[model samples]
Target: MISRHRKVLREARVVGSERRGTWVYYWVLPPALERLPALLQVPEPAASTSW
Candidate 1:
């Protein structure tokens, strides 16, 4: 499933990766992070105790 997402992102030019030996490393383009909303999305209110 992850590989499928990676392929999509790669085709969209949203990310890049490199394969080394038996491992593959993936990365989101640096500028993309800045364009994204905060990683936590809507902040939890103080009284919200559970996810």
Candidate 2:
């Protein structure tokens, strides 16, 4: 899991991380932050009239 996260961060180039003591913290870079909403959006599901 950690490897996968690292790979994505490296590939995206839109995340910044810092280590404080034993903990590492990450945040979206400014340019990426501006586009984050659109990146995270998903299409609405089709309406279901019958359950």
Candidate 3:
């Protein structure tokens, strides 16, 4: 599943998967953390004109 998204993941600076035993873990390098806030940002609501 993840292999299909390699290009996007690489651009996002994700370090790919690590397999230990039966488990797989995905890691993001420090630079990716800086992008998290922008990805999760919420726009402010518009003000109501009616009183």
lDDT of the candidates, in the order given:
0.82, 0.83, 0.76
Residues 19-40, candidate 1, lDDT per residue (tens digit)? 9999988899887677677754
TM-score of each: 0.56, 0.50, 0.53
lDDT of model 3, residue 20: 95
TM-score of 1: 0.56
Better of 1 and 2 by TM-score: 1
RMSD of each: 6.5, 4.2, 3.7
Clashes of 2: 0
* Lowest-sum lDDT 10-residue window in model 1: 31-40
Residue 30, model 3: lDDT of 75
Question: Which lDDT tens digits does candidate 3 get at residues 1-51?
Answer: 766686588666765666899987787777778878998999999988986
Off by over 4 Å in 2: 37-51
TM-score of 2: 0.50
Highest lDDT scorer: 2
Query: After best superposition, candidate 2 residue 11: deviation in angstroms?
Result: 3.4
Tens-place lDDT per residue, model 2, 1-51, is 996887698579788888899997887789888988999999999988986
